[model samples]
Target: MILVPGLWLWRDPWLQWAAGCAGAIRAAGSQPVWFGYSRRVAWTAFLRPTGGTAAELVRRFLALYDRVRARHGPPSVIAHSFGTYLVTRALSDFEGARLRALILFGSIVSETFDWGTIVARGQVTPARMRNEVGAHAAIVRLAAALRRFGYPYGESGVTGFQLDELSRSVNVRYTGPWLADSALARYCRGVWVPLLRPTHPPRRSVLTLRSRELSRT
Candidate 1:
């Protein structure tokens, strides 16, 4: 299993998720390797007005992929939140990466997901009783439309946008702050705990580049 933790969550005291995943994989009789990316390589970076930083981060990810594949066979990748962005970018980097499985949790890829069923299940309520419309209805419509015709953000010419298509094989498991229930907590505890307690925590200063711009000042 290839575990990837979310942004800032990859930092020690926050990277418990990766360790937890590793443990789970071990318990299931499989060896897991943690694959972490810098926080600056966030999803928003891909959409920023100046996407130079995101482009550079993508290049670094490609280099990391070379090393990981050389050491480990194309393995099952598990990504959460911001790290999901990296997983998508990396998959787009190589065609024959041999991804066994992709488990995505707390997904931040789309602003809206399946909500019709969520509302029927009482997961959310209409903002105004009189309006009779869930707040996230619009986003669900957008996601539906995009999924129908493939990715909507970029054209075929775009380098990284191609990863959006891989969702078909990627097993997505979403855990929103809204879904703060016991079952959800237990399912994600493994990923969340170890990320919070790392043996060699990364320095916060290591994050010099921001997703928004190249200028640190």
Candidate 2:
């Protein structure tokens, strides 16, 4: 399994989490390969993804994937945050059986990602976000933002925007928060009163990037 970390992190927890997950996979009779990437990134990049940024990340992961295959044969992958997104893009065009399972945790990917194309080559993205974070009001707020941008967001069993394809081998599980559908998620949700909402409208220029994102399929 390859352990990928989220934005702005490439070490420590990524390595530590890999150790723990590797232990588990070993216990189950598997060899795990933890792939690591950029250790740092400008925080502002999240708000404004540079053109080709995603493609570049995918290219890096593809290079690592090739190295992993040559050294350890096809192995299952486990990625978190941006790592998951990177892996997804890396394998989307892959046509070989050099991969086994794909387990994503806290994946920050759009729902419309081409899962079907990748699954045909044999790997699946987990669609268990909403269930796992339903109780965390903070996550709900985040998911809402994801939804506003047409990204996959909310509810257990929710496959927000992936292609209309299914994989029997796919394993989707909600392992935390589970707040999107919870009463607490609803109650503590921010900006309940419209009057309490931001008084000043955001600058029109600020909406340009977001508008482009939403306008895309």
The whole-model lDDT of each prediction reads 0.43, 0.46
- In candidate 1, which residue ranges exceed 4 Å CA deviation? 9-16, 38-50, 110-217
> Considering every candidate listed, which one attains the maximal lDDT?
2
Clashing pairs in 1: 13-196, 14-195, 15-194, 15-195, 16-193, 16-194, 16-195, 16-196, 17-191, 17-195
Compose the digit string of candidate 2's lDDT tens values, residues 98-121: 454454545555655666666555
Model 1, 1-217: lDDT tens per residue? 5566554532441334455445556664556666545555554553451367656655665666566657654455565544555555555444444443445453444433332333344322222101111212333343334544554222111111112332222222233232223343445345433332323433434345463355644
**How much does candidate 2 score in TM-score?**
0.55
lDDT of 2 at 191: 12
Q: What lDDT is reached at residue 185 by model 2?
A: 23
How much lDDT does candidate 1 score?
A: 0.43
